[model samples]
Target chain A: MSQLSGNTKWSVAKLKERSPVRWHERIGETSIFIISLASILLIMLMAIFILKEGLMVFINPSIRAEVNFRELFLKTVWQPISEVPKYSLLPLIAGTLKTSFVALLIALPLGMLAALFISECAPKWLSEFVKPTIELLAAIPSVVIGFFCLMKVASWLAHAYEIKWLHDALTPHRLNTLVGGIGISIAVVPITFTLCEEAFHGVPESYRAASIALGATKWQTALGVVIPTAMPGVIAAILLSFGRAWGETMIALMATGNAPLLDLNILHSVRTLAATVGAEMPEVVVGSSHYHVLFLIGTILLSISFTVNGLSQLAISSLRKKLTGG
Target chain B: MNANRRRFRLPKGSEASGLALTLLSAIATLIVLSMLAIILVDLGSGGYRKLSWEFLTKPPEQGMTGGGIFPAIFGTMFLVIIMTLMVMPVGVLTAIYLNEYAPKHALITRLIRTSISNLAGVPSIVYGMFGLSFFILFLGRRIDSLIGAELLFGQPCLLWAAATLSILTLPVAVTATEEALAAIPEELRLASYALGATKWQTIWRVVFPKAMGGILTGAILTVSRGAAEVAPLLFTGVAYYLPQLPLSPTSQFMHLGYHIYVMATQSPDVEATMPLQYATALVLLALTFLLNLIAILIRVRLRIIAGEV
Candidate 1:
């Protein structure tokens, strides 16, 4: 390889500058570079646009006069259309946290365990069938899943867990954080399982053998040795899934009752930043503060996802370093 | 330490614990699969009756409560096709650069990799906002001014929607194509070089053809994603109700996922629109499955060829 490059390097550089063939190759390289850099360009542009538009409510006195930065976040209500409008982001933030908490509580265990089983214990046939089956769930549009939750699961759960004494708990809408959380869990399970499964696969076989050689049982070897060794990857998977559940929109929008209320009640509905952006972006007037508030929510969502993704990347790199001894 | 103690505390019956975890995992897998099964069954049962020849070919009437979703389906196809055209070349080229051109661990290479990873992690709705402000409001308006048109390109339309979706699915295509390129052994490239072909010549003559199935699969997945995704389309170009088919890329259009959302949420009577929603969902699911099946087939064929080779 070095010899070939050594022979071609000098003349190739000259050829690249002048010859048509080399020029074509150079053009090809430049086009590929531009395309490869497209996402970076888009990411920068998106962050800037969202930040610029979203910060308008905070910086512009006219917009700030409508909604104070401190009060908009500190207060409980989110009546953007009220006689005295309030754009408190707290309710939305709390609701997002609650929904994501519930979703993670459900998905992490299910996804991780299923992934563990597929990678560690499941028979070949079982793994083959189950892996694709879980992945197929990923393909079903979130709206359809939301629709199912709204039409079927919400009512079913409401009836199944009805308490006559607490009649108001199950509102007429019958949609709540728990129902939406469960539906979103279904969406996130695929992501978590796929990632965790890959992580499990990354655990070196020698470690498992060493554990067993040291008289550890299959269960201990699998759980105690395997999971910890793959912990970085597994944790990254968990973090990323949490990000997904946080940013999930259609399910939350459809099945969360769309109430911008500040409550920790998992049984009741709440809104999220992503859902707020999707639900409200259309109705607001162009360049209005209401519009900027939605953009602000988008900006918040973007940063959160960015942070989670950055964390996941760090974890993966650390895990790679550990494996490679670099 | 509590963590060390927990790790050191070995349970007595190794076989029993292993069996217990096996059962638990099996149950979890079963639950996941059953959920998919139940959803497909529910959609099939609810929608099979609604879909007919007319349903596939006609536009809506009566506030979209009484007609087929031909326009939505058509617009979906239009959007997916355009997105495919826009994303495939760039995605394929980017993948080529990542796998073939760029050195292993250069700073620019690492930066690009990080950018790709973060881009993949960005939420879909965020892409919608970006598309609206950046593409429609910013670039679209600028293009309109340059072209001396009034609101022609400065609004949500098929072109902008497809463009937004192009960015959304770019990472998927790049990753898939990179995988395809990686799957081809280094020996193939060495052989081409020994035969006196230039780097580009070798890539064009040997590597790309071998990798075509995978590249096509990636491009097809991008199209499938265009069909399944709705949040990004919420603001870009999808009209809640567009009776007319989009005559041009500049025209706003209907989309299957958005149509389902509208029928389920916006109909005066949600109960009345339930059947239509089911049918639309079914069609969308079917298209997604069909695309996935093609990708799976290409992958299977690749595996077979690899085995033979």
Candidate 2:
């Protein structure tokens, strides 16, 4: 026993002594630590580089002489290729908000209810079938979703407009904001469904038990106890999905008719900030005010996404704390 | 209360509302599911006739209104292969560092977590802008200047596209890998340490092998995610129509998503290319779907092995 104890102490001493293995261990940890910082570095670089290029619209003397900050914000027209180029963000912002809000309006109720069903009401076999099906919806590429909207949904909506009541409700443009909103919702709903399902699942079983023991019906427990407990997570889900709809490019590019029309009617064809960048960035001359304006649009998009994501993260973390009581 | 009865009977009035709510939500789920079904069936039917062996193997002819998407397929594969190579190591290592090395509650740890979440949320179009400004113009120009090249590195090409894509998908790879790493029980790590193995040795020899399934899932998910992105690649390297494959890192390439986008929106005759668009979309969808299915299967197997399911 003494020998064993002495041997253990000697090994510990040896481990503490500087060795090649120790050197490798130090190198490995340090290398991984550096590698781990790559994400932060990339994000910083992205912000810096985008800001450098994007802010040129305001900072560069030549660019400002042509397209000033006031024109970008206040001017309604976005014609950048005419003899006297104009750079306005109002139409794009209006289009983006309209389409994304419409998408949320369509997606929120359906996604929340579907998630409620999958989480609380469905049988095991049924939930399993529904869950992956929704995930498959997510796996569909944005480009594909965009194509579907352009080809089928547009035609369907155009056809539906022949009916008097449907004509009153539906957009007449083949590729209108309404069609774009529906297309974006196809992409947004899956995310909303998945996240809301997770939120519902996160509700404690004991909470449900207590509600049930109080003679509450299943729906009453789900509504009165479970959903209230998971409200933050639900909000996070909706916010994240809204962020997704806002940032979506391919769907907006293909489905929204790419027209920068500042119109309130959902039937009017509209353009989005993201789609403008996607559609116009490839052709714009390098270092031109047009290019910088696109980058400015990108900067706006990045900030919006960051803010929304931060809000969602806050909601999620708060929910975690509330659930765990930590 | 009835004196004769021992058990209490619950009121049945609320059951109707419960059933009604269930029915309503079930309808919602049904609507969502039918949407997916409609998309798949429509695309499958529309593209079915055009999807042939010749269509898969040949190149486009007559201004892309009639042709196969072989170049797009090749380019997508090349892009994803390089992207997978770049992302897997950094992403897996970052995950390892987070799950195993970093001290809990450290500021650096929180920053990294926040950055990863934000990275995942940054719009894909913004990634395209960054790819153009940072990767192509700035870094590429610097490289060209250093190498005394005229325009090779300063132009949009495969390397920068792959690099941009790898960054965009980094969060996916990291999150998946972290989940896998966390799934590993604490006792296993304790056992490895108890064997007098160094931290590096245990991480390399024991932990890595055990985490292989998760790593593979991360890799596949990364590939699938990177392969489908069109916006970032648009300015980075993707070409509208590349007659030649991206034989070198500095060469521009074609992609299925970009192909579909251009064909549907910009083809000379959109009606003529409609079938081609649908076919290309189908191919892209199949690739991503297959990859996701594989990842899910691997995860399910891992869960089974870990006795979690």
Candidate 3:
């Protein structure tokens, strides 16, 4: 091997001496560099175009007459098709928050408990079964989840309302914030489970060993040591899932009844920012204020997702360094 | 020492608490599993009778209330094909650059990583919005103006939707290929170098073949993603119902997800089309599921090979 290396190095040097430039290699590197830049380029163009069109609500004269930053941020109604055409983002924001709140309320505990079960409690065979089941669940498309929520979950909730005692607890609306939240939670749980499981897995084996060596019970060690050490990751998971539920479109559009109601009732149908875009963008007049407003909603979704994902990335990296001693 | 000692103590009822928590999480897992099970059972039982060769091959009849969803299946396949052609070359090359050519810890590399992660996190509807504004209104219209065509390239069509979806799934391909590339031992590249192979030659001749499985996995995953995506296509190119197949890149196409969405929401007689909705959903769910299963199997095989490496 050394001889081969030496002979190749000598020949390569001689060859290089003969030809001072390797044009093909340089071209190859440059082309690959350009191709690799496409992702960055695409992302930049996405931000630019989305921002340009979205910000038209402020810049365009006609759009500005009907809508302004104050109307978008300060006002509460989101009726963009009326004669007056209000474009306040507060209702949509409230809707996004309410649905995400319901999603997190259900998903957080279930996801964390499932992660705990798989990582620290379940047998190996059981973990194997559960992990792939979660993956399969993750692979199920959002649209299908939306369809299911629309067809089955809503009907089931409606039926649940029929029982006299459960009336107060249930939403009277068949398709409401609670139903959308449940649908989003289905999408959110796999993500939460995967991330939290990784976090739990990242807690070094020695930590568990030491805790066990000290005569601590398995659940005691898990609850006291592993979960706490992995708390940042769990938090990151929750944040990421929140971002997901916040930006989720199809399920919300399908299940939430597409009403921009500013009510606090979980049973009341609400329209989310993402869902509003999906539900309205197709029918919206091109180049109208409504079009720009939808784009603006897109802008809001883009920025919120970017921020949430960035923070989660930071949390994961910090957790990695702390737990892995990197 | 005293604090540490107290912290690790096996207090009374610890065992019972352990049992209770374990049972509780097990129930949580059961609920999650049942969620999957309920959807599958509902879709399968509801859709099974409706699915047939005729249903798979024939076009919808009576305003999508009666007949099959052949056009949706065809358009989805066509969309996936176009997207695969567009995404694979760029996605694989991006992975090659990041894993093989990138200077470690460089600023530009960090920028690319950040961009990819952000792209992955951007909502699908945002992609739809971006596609509408950027690809359709901006780039497509520019092409139309350059060629002096009247609304030819400016409208939503198969090409633009595929382009939008390609970008959305680019990170999936890049990540998978990077994982595959990273798994190759450093010694292999060194050996190729020692044989007087240039960097490009080594990657093309030696590393690329070894990473082929990973690339295939990426392709399958990308195809499945493109097939499943409907939000971005809402405005880009997908039609509510096209009379003819999208035989050209410039033409609009039907999509399975959009079909289901439109039928479930906009159909005048939602009750009449319930069976058709279930069948279409099942077909879509099965397509994505099968593709994902293939990808996972390939991934597991790659892992075994990577372990050997």
Candidate 4:
């Protein structure tokens, strides 16, 4: 008993005199705060660098005075590599809008209805089986999708739409806005489906029960009440995916044949802003005017995506606030 | 009473209209599902022929027309592993700070969350540009000058490539880990505090173990997404045809997705290398799917166990 008491006393003295852990609490806290703070700083730095590089086009009086900002930015000519360099962003913006618009047109209805089916109509087992399978679509890389389209779908589309009944002598080619849009639709569908389903699921059970109780059929309740309640979120999903499709690089790079044509024709090839940067940035000389122009394209891509993403995020949060009556 | 009765009663022909609309929605669902089915079936048949032992083990022969994708595979694996290591710690720590330490509803918290979400939405090409301009050009050039080396870090290499990818995937890792940390019950932390543990001690002892599955899922997701990405690699470190595996972090490496892109678009004979392209796509797809499946299995198992807990 005396020996045990002596041992305990000695250990207590040692414990009180010397701390066991290597790091003091304040030291650990400061390091963690710094680590977390560094991530935010890094993100800020990257954004600023891209913006600064892009702003060079506007900041350089030589280029701005030589080139009309509006005409260079809004016109159709984009030949930077030639002897007479005219960098117009119109065609790329037009291509982005055309492809993303087409993709949303195909995806929105299909994804909305799929979401409706999954949330309201399908049985427990089928809904369970389908959601994961559809989400697996999101796992498919854009590059693989582009490759598949380039080799198989493009040729198939060219032949499939090789009919004169479409009223144009210019036929659909293997690489066109239509094929790129279709490839992008495959990627967009999963995103729209996932978000739309969440919106639909978020519609309260009481709303559904009350609608059905008031003698509305299941379909009527879903189409009228549930969808209307979830409409904001659903629209946000579409805009979010619009941003996705617009910003997608690999699919457009590979499948669209990268023809920078300033036309509204879906059957003709179009090169997107993202595709232009991906294809042209590598060969460009460092610190050259061409490189700065590519950065301008990146800036354009960033702003469009940022605007779309911000709008969707705003829409979603407001919807959440309204729905929660906060 | 009569109005109420009428409102409760089904109007004539309503059921038929409802059935028709339901049918339309179901058909839309079928169309989307069918596309998935078709793509998988098409890729399966097309890529299956090129999945041979020699194909996986040997380097490209005949101008990348007949050789296996061993070098590309090896490079991709190295890139993803290094990227995962680089990203996982930073991401998890950020997530931990957000979920555990940060004061809720604070301006700093909101700012951090918004920036993190915004980071995820930035396009791959933009990230590629950032890596090239800032990382390789600015940072790498400065390092080269300081070290008296000739264009060592100022050019495309595995280091800048992995670093760029780590940034690209930061959002995925943080989001997943945040979700994981949020999944831990508040009572667990309270209980640790009741038992005389410090906040740091509680985090290390109580929260981390419970959140391991979620953090792992996020890590796997980041790795899969990073591994398959080719655009950012186009300028960062990917070689046109360096079949000899990347010897070091500063060395250029061939990538599977880039290999497929090269084969698809720039090959002298596109038709001949088309099979190899599909095969490469298949391997990339398989790798992505396999990682996702592992993450899913881990998540489902954790959920079941968590349910009991």
Candidate 5:
């Protein structure tokens, strides 16, 4: 009886040690998991807070009475400081879209062409230098870019336009949306070029050889076969660039005249939601209706960026699936 | 006959176009170089004479008419240093955890990755709002150099500006560090484990040291970015003028970025110091460029060493 009891007691003690060891291991894993979860939760809370404060503008009847949503959305004027603060988002929205679209127009072709040159046509030595040089553009801060735009690009554009009689007569503001758009285009090009170049580089050499074997010209192979293979990546690059342009603040603030007036002409001065938030958010009375309105604008900006990024990711995954299946 | 003609023409066409392509790439490079040149020229022509030792060492006098960027410079450095100290460890550790320890397909891991990416896209101004509300108001902490009973160090009172800039640069640091950690060969980890080493010991002893160069490269980039940021500092509390140098961490400090912004936009006497503004901008740009150059150099050295090893 004594010998049997001794064996059973030893087994029980071993089981007890193993259980605590497993418990401690599980706790360590849980804590690490929780830390990551908390960080993400904090960011989401930031988004929710902005949205909550911004939505207050629509919910409160008093603020709604101050500015009609219909007129704010549709009207040409954006005189937010007027006796009746017209909060027409048209001018700001139009300015942002026009500048961003023009930027996209210039950046897309130039960036893709640049990518093609670097990836396909340039010698290895040339590519070695070109890749880093292009990447350096991405590293330059936006404020520095803004300073250049303000001091250099704007004046250059003004001087160039001054020589054209018709251009001067047609546009009063030399520092207009067009100038801002062009400056922003310069900023986006490097980014697009980097991503697109990477995508093009990822294309297999076998595909290029296959096309060449079929008697396709180099340009023809690149444009027809390689580009199609990298289409999803190219689209993702363009969308990401667009999102960047849409959110850019300092360049628009410095180059655009900060005029809140609504107009379609690329020559007209304009304001963006980002610029507005930057210029005015500091002075805004905390928790006031105007303050909340600014937060709402942030929410709008976030939503737009989220949509663009989401679409890009979706397109990339779908393309991957298709490519892999075939 | 057709085959001979095509074969003869193809090499010639490619060579000519290749030359043209090289030229275009050169021009693309020139565009960036020219922009930098124009900025340097404009600043030099406008403010080179005024960039004296006194201009960099003295405090602002007579509403900045006497021309001093000492306070601003101190504030920028203090903010960047503090931010780097706070962000580097957290960012590097989190990166290690993500790359080495975390299970793939875990919800928490995906959330962290997505948030960091999304945060990168959020505008600087929005970060200002978040900082102002959470750091200043919600915490009920005045933008001063003290926390309860402790004297926190650095100019612009280091803590506030540090927190703001840390948030701004965290995503970059985390992303870069993760990339570095990911680049480590799995065999290294397995070798250590095969020798009966614990997982943490293996990562600490082997993986991190190998990835240090890339980690430092990322840290340098983060510091450069933090130094250039203007919008967030505006809200977080960068004083435009300081009568005394921020010799101690507890001293009130002014920052260069805010001073430039003030000189350019809000100065009461813009005409008198227009050149001063340009010079200040020049100094800031040069500083950023130099920092970036250092980062690139480190990256190149690492690649070479990595190759040789």
Candidate 6:
């Protein structure tokens, strides 16, 4: 009976010791959970506030009366300082599109060819050197690139092309959309090349060997088999580069002729939505229509970029599934 | 048929074409090299003749045309130091929470990750807006001085610039720190747990030290990026010219990034000292490049160490 009582006492002591420890662990875990949740909530709150403030510009009839929504959408003029103050987005949109498309046109072939050269044609040592050097380009600041373009590339283009028509089109200012496009191409090429190279390298060596054993040339095997398999990744790279080009501000602000006019010619000066926001947001008076309009622009930019990024991510995942059959 | 097939084969191009292809790569390299070269040449022709000991030491004499970069340099250093202090703790702690403490299946974990990615996409100008609204206006405090009326400045302070930069760099620091933390092996954690160490203790003692090199690399990169940024500072408060040195933490000072921007674009006197603008650009570029090199070096060293271990 005494031994049984002693055993009961021991069991009680063990339970008492373990209960507090478990309680403390639970408390700690719960606190961490709350903190993490709070951080996320804060971000969501910021996004919601931005959207709410931005929408107010459209909802207020007094503000909307000043600038017709249709004209803003369809018209190409973007003079914000004139008597009428037309807010036509077409000129900016066209400028942005032209520059980005030209950039893609230049970067796409070069990036793919560079990827092919690095992954297939080059020696391993050369591959290692080239890969990191290309990545280093991504790390360089956009502002530095902008400075270089403003100082040198614009002048170089003027000298090289020397087209009388182009010169006439860009008489007063040296910087133009074409110069912006070329500068942006320099930035985008490295990123696309890196992604494409990785994708190409990811293709199994056995496939290449099989194509070669079937008597295909090295170039044929690469072009016919490797490039096809890596198409989705290459597309993803292109989309990513597109998004970056669209969102870029410093280079656009510095190099693009800040003329907010509706000219479609590549040699003419133009401005993008991002550059406008960067240039004007700092000086915008608090709670003014201009401030709300800037916010609206931000909202548009965010949504557009989000869509592009989402599409790229979706493409990448689907490609992964297709490749793995999973 | 075989004899005809051999006759129909295409001839190889001359070695000249191969040389041209190789030259194309060399030209790409030259693009980067020439930027450096142009900056050097411009600075050498303009600033090399003018730069003296006084240029480094003197205050602005007449709206930056006559003065050295003393105040701007001091201001930049001050802002960087304060920003580092503010960001390092919060960023590192948040990274620790994500990597070590948070549960894998939790929605909060996923949300934090998404928010970080989105935050990185947000332009620097947006951060300036946030700082103006929240820190300067809503808080009803002096937004310019380092310490404000609370202590040293006895007035509204310029330290708000540093605070603004801290937010600007937080995402970078968090992403980098998380990457570093993630690199630590699960086996290390398990061993620590098996030894009866607490989770916090294991993280503090084993994981943090191992991850320090990467974290430092991230910090360096963040600082470099912060140093180059100008648009946000225009709103946060960096003066074009400061007459006095930023001797105290409370004293307001000029910054090189802002100085360069103002000199290049907004300055009333551009013709006489346009070369000064180029020299400033060279300085900014060199600073950014040096920081990048340092960060890369640290990252490479850490990777080597990790591999050896």
Worst 10 residues of 1 chain A by lDDT: A164-173
Where does the lowest 10-residue lDDT sum fall in candidate 1 chain B? B5-14
* Higher-scoring candidate on TM-score, 1 or 3: 3
Q: List candidate 6 stretches off by more than 4 Å.
A: A1-42, A82-84, A107-112, A160-172, A201-218, A319-325, B1-53, B101-106, B133-160, B244-253
lDDT of 4 at A121: 91
Give the alpha carbon lDDT tens digit for every residue of A147-219 in model 4. 8888878888877675777626666666999889999899899989999999999999999999988878898
Clashing pairs in 3: none
Give the Å shift of residue A130 in candidate 2.
2.1
Regions more than 4 Å wrong, model 5 = A1-32, A319-326, B1-37, B40-47, B141-158, B244-253
lDDT of 3 by residue, B93-123 (tens): 9999999989988999998998999898999
- Isolated chain A: TM-score per model? 0.91, 0.93, 0.91, 0.88, 0.88, 0.86
Worst 10 residues of 4 chain B by lDDT: B300-309
lDDT of 1 by residue, B1-309 (tens): 999778766667867877888899878877777778988998999999999999988888787788798999899999999999998888888899899998888987888788788878888999999999999999999999999998999999999999999988888888999999999899999999888677888888899999998888888777887788999999998998765789899999998988888777777898888898999989999999888878877877888889952
Question: Model 5, B73-115: lDDT tens per residue?
Answer: 8778977888899878767767877888877888867778877
Residue range A78-193, candidate 5, lDDT tens digits: 66665777677788888888889877887777788778878877788877777766666666566666666666677787776766785766674756787788778877888788
- TM-scores, one per candidate: 0.94, 0.95, 0.95, 0.94, 0.86, 0.82
Candidate 2 residue runs with Cα over 4 Å from true position: A1-21, A164-171, B1-13
Question: Candidate 1 vs candidate 2: which has greater TM-score?
Answer: 2
Better of 4 and 6 by DockQ: 4
Candidate 1 residues lying further than 4 Å off, grouped into runs, are: A1-21, A166-173, B1-10
Report per-prediction Cα RMSD to one decimal: 3.5, 3.2, 2.9, 5.2, 5.8, 6.1
List per-prediction Cα lDDT, in the order shown. 0.86, 0.91, 0.90, 0.87, 0.74, 0.71
Clashing pairs in 4: none
Query: What DockQ does predicted model 3 obtain?
Result: 0.76
DockQ, all models: 0.63, 0.69, 0.76, 0.61, 0.33, 0.25
lDDT of 6 at B146: 42
Q: Per-residue lDDT for A193 in model 5?
A: 88
